[model samples]
Target: MAPRRYCRARLGGQSRWFLDRGDHLLDLQSAVDGDDVPALLRHLADTDVTWAPPGGAVQVDPARVEWQVPVPRPGKVICLGLNYAAHAAEGGNAPPEYPALFLRAATSLIAHDAPLIRPRASDRLDFEAELAVVIGRRARHLDAAQALSAVAGYACFNDGTLRDYQRRTSQWTVGKNFDGTGAFGPWLVPAADLPPGATGLSIESRLNGQVMQRDNTGHMMVSVTQALVLLSEVFTLEPGDVIAMGTPAGVGYARTPPVFMKAGDRIEVEIEGLGVLANTVEDET
Candidate 1:
């Protein structure tokens, strides 16, 4: 088989990167003309290259550009709920006997630097900084040991929620899938470099330089591998699919006075090794 080549658009303006199937770096402009993505990925799988080209025609200053999600389209965006113990306690509950799960439809997908729009339908939008796993291969009924092997990489994710509706109903779907609600990326650091096997880790959320939610992944009721295996038992996860491990304690809705998002507010979600996801809230016109 040829090496698998994964094309990635970098955060800097006009700069792009590609990771071949073997995870080796490839030339940035090799994809400038926009090659057939899937086909390139297939070819990259069998070959190995260690270094990328030194320069390109377009130069970009990092400070002036906006970031975008790593993948433009994904087959599925799987989300976990109450997976963190402290978060469950904050919500006035015990760790679920099983991992609580949910799905955020594709429409909710947005990039890292994009504005998080205040959903017109709800005003209680909230932020959840989480460790997200991106699947690299088709998986189903995999044992816990095999779960991590199926992961493509890791990235930061903000599981934005519409609080009023989330609390108003038992099903969390409606409140979770509003436009610009799921902000993930700027990059997909391959699984090899990221801590694997669902071990302990930390995740945090901040607003205007103030830390709001800070918790460790070690407290997750179900480890990342466990969540992957459990979800795989039911649904087939494909490459590029994402899973938001879960948020920690201290969500705005769980606060004493409840601190919800308002227009003109800036939020950032950071995870141990994944990187940071930042967005500014803006009124939905």
Candidate 2:
């Protein structure tokens, strides 16, 4: 059976869910307001969702809708920072003994194809490509062996950063939580579709059509299972909550002649099996 993929979208102010069908969207739910994660979580528990629904698949053209963040309003948008040894070294820091984690506000996220807003406060917008893990159900205190079961799926993410604000304080929250800077989702591929923890997958990022970062998920210092286990020990990971696996080396701020994104720049993050997430930068008016 083919793997399942989903896209949460908005059309004319109504939220809807769609299963990805070849070249079209198979409408999976009636139009509703607010998030669409609860329904999916229920369906996920019952079956694999590998077959098309009975009503001949109510399909729509891809262009008819606007994409929304995979988990539109995550209860927690926890992120792993400096989770790659090489990425840590690039910033003149040694590998961490524990995962460097941070929280990102939902306001910071933009959907695939949406314009990534470069705030007026800074022209130092930077991109960090990453893999996002979506929690499947409520989980707490899970050990490493049980961690993979807590994951619902995976998506591509661009952890857009503002360099100056990031350095102004010891905490990275301010810079990382700027509205509309984070880019997430084109689609979410079910965990059953890929290797466990999505390991060994090739992940890459591009700026204005030029490859800027490239690496494999296997190289992460803290693997997906480890991150989940570690996180669940402290707090519960509920359905639709997201965890952004840290980016690999080659970020703009670390380059020889620091490169940053400006208005009209395009950025894309792609991961094997998961779809590509692309966005164009626009200045805050």
Best by lDDT: 2
Q: Can you give the TM-score per candidate against the true fold?
A: 0.84, 0.95
Q: How do the residues 1-285 of candidate 1 rate in per-residue lDDT, one tens digit apiece?
A: 221223355543453544433323444564342223333223232224333445633433444444546655777888899988888998998888987788888778887778988888888989898887777777789997677887766778899999887777788888898888888875566566555643566789998879999988888777888888888889998776789888998889999899989998999987776556788899888
Q: Model 2: which residue pairs collide? A: none
- Tell me each candidate's RMSD, in Å, in order: 5.1, 1.8
**lDDT against the true structure, each candidate:** 0.73, 0.87
Judge candidate 2 against the unseen true structure and give its global Cα lDDT, from 0 to 1. Answer: 0.87
Q: Which portions of model 2 show Cα errors greater than 4 Å?
A: 30-34, 45-47
Clashing pairs in 1: 2-45, 2-46, 3-44, 3-45, 3-46, 3-47, 4-21, 4-44, 4-45, 201-217
RMSD of 1: 5.1
Q: Which stretches in model 1 have alpha-carbon errors above 4 Å?
A: 1-15, 18-27, 31-59, 64-66
